[model samples]
Target: MKKGSATVAQLSEFDEIIDVRSPAEFADDHIPGAVNMPVLDDAQRARVGTIYKQVSPFEARRIGGALVAENLARHLHAHFQDKPKHWRPLVYCWRGGQRSGAFVTWLRMVGWDACQLEGGYKNFRRMVIDALAQQPATLDFRIIGGATGSAKTRILEALAAAGAQVLDLEGLASHKGSVLGALPGVAQPTQKKFETALHAVLSRFSPDRPVYVEAESRKIGRVHLPTELMEAMRGSPCFAIDASREARIEFLLRDYAYLGDDVADLQRKLGCLNRIISNETLARWQDYAAVHDLPALFTELVDQHYDPLYKRSQNSNYVRFGDAIHVSTDDLSPSGIIAIADAILAKTPVRADAR
Candidate 1:
């Protein structure tokens, strides 16, 4: 790598990664761990673009240059005040263009070893895409299969806590992988950002060690899983959690207790099932929510909707579903889930090749 520029692969060599793109751009997707320090913020970028299109390119640059200088000065006095003289940072903009180039030049003039990303976020994005396409197949995966409310995610969390390799798809997507899975006050990451998160996690995992993940449809909320990963997961061996109906209902009532806080919101979510569930049935479910009769609502949903859908999808999609090792559990509490995770870890000893 040159002293003034670096590639995506050289990300670790820097003391800090700085993205000089606008805040909106940074929010949509960015290199993992990169800090946002916009040379031209959203409004300023829009103003400059308008000028470039309507007035002249030269005029836009003249105005944008002043704004960049002002923002950089503010950043130096405020954000960068504690930085040491030897701090080495990698700076990038959308396309490794004027914004990051100007920022890097100013930093180098300040006697800091600041390099521009060779192709900026565009290059990094390409690397993420390529990694997502190829990396998932390299790992050994174990699917956690179960009906809705089976606490599969909890089991995966327990496995991770017990020092096992686990890929949490739902957590990464910020959705629970159902119509009612949207988390309160939490927005899901953009599809690109989700893919970036996936790449980051997969890069850290050891391929020889079994990576436990929950079974999911191709689409989780709004973002879709990579085709490569979906294919890899379908072909991998599975462990089915055969929790009893009562246990599942109890688990769900506890897990989805948040839904009971706002009866109107809960009814609105239930209204989404109007197409599949009859009007009378939907009205009855809404009434249950209105009355806070969660047990009845969950029981009907499990027996009528989630369980049937899960059965069909698992049988049709997962090649190894029938052959899955059935792990029975009547308890879905934290302690019980931990016990299950421990049993799984003990049963599947790490292979010598994994080490």
Candidate 2:
């Protein structure tokens, strides 16, 4: 009767991790590496649910028990028949209740050392939420601040490559943290998934070392930053990157090359700003796209929209913006970004104990 805690380290001790929730539940979110071996699949769960609501509980249990028994037989015969007697597995369902209990009963009956997660996926999710609410306060952060097309993301990557700890918010959210931030054909994860991913990354860093991250507003696309983390970032020391106008435009053209391939998507994104910018202005931007004049359109967009918006919001949002260490680069190329990463590391002192 081995028992596992809801913590990641405790859960990682098992030989195999099995999730018994329905496919849809697993799809929405689950422990990162747990294998899905649903006790009742999506359709079966729905059918059982319908029976429970529309029919008598007694009748529903009768039908569900028969279904469960048949599914268990198939799993034992098809999936577990080859396994040895001493196989150890961690099993869990929604709330560490009936579904996992039933599965565990059968597995133990078959002579396997199977254990149930004490609180299940719900418990794991709660742990992540609580961590997100509290953990950022323990970390020391250095934010990277700059206007659009400043290659902040690229610089973060280079820093990570140089053995510095970095929290890439944009990468985690799968949105570039702007109006045109959404990556084409790549969908963002659910909020729960994002939080889970964030927790995983944060837990890996030591509290003593500074985490380098790009400056982001509270919201990144549809997902919002954890309140504690947002507040910490606003007050943290920052590195302000300054690049030339020509350099920024060139950098953007390369970074957002997808927009050129699908001009319609570009126009659609531009149209979203109709409320702030006039319809005529949006139409003009669309016309620029119609002729594939992205450089021209992007230049105007930064000067008219992104730059002004950044100037107004950043100073107020990030309290330390005025004291940010300025890192100016005339080149925004790959080598240039690596050079910028080197420059930042040179000025930014890693904590004495970080080594």
Best by TM-score: 1
Q: Which lDDT tens digits does candidate 1 get at residues 1-355?
A: 6669999999999999999999999999999999999999999999999999999999999999999999999899888878999999999999899999999999999989999999899999999999999998799988899999889999999999999999999999999998889899899999989999999999999977899999999999999999999999998888889999999999999999999898998999899889998999999999999999999999999999999999888978888888887889999999999988887777664652221
Total clashes for model 2: 0
Give candidate 1 misplaced runs (Cα > 4 Å). Answer: 349-355
Compared with the true structure, the alpha-carbon lDDT of candidate 2 equals 0.87
For each candidate in turn, give its C-alpha RMSD to the true structure in angstroms: 2.0, 2.6
**Tens digits of lDDT, candidate 2, 118-170:** 88898889889999998888888998999899999999999999999999999
TM for every model, in the order presented, reads 0.97, 0.93
> Weakest 10 consecutive residues, lDDT, candidate 2?
1-10
Model 1: residue 56 alpha-carbon error in angstroms:
1.2
On lDDT, the leading prediction is 1
Question: How does each model score on lDDT?
Answer: 0.92, 0.87
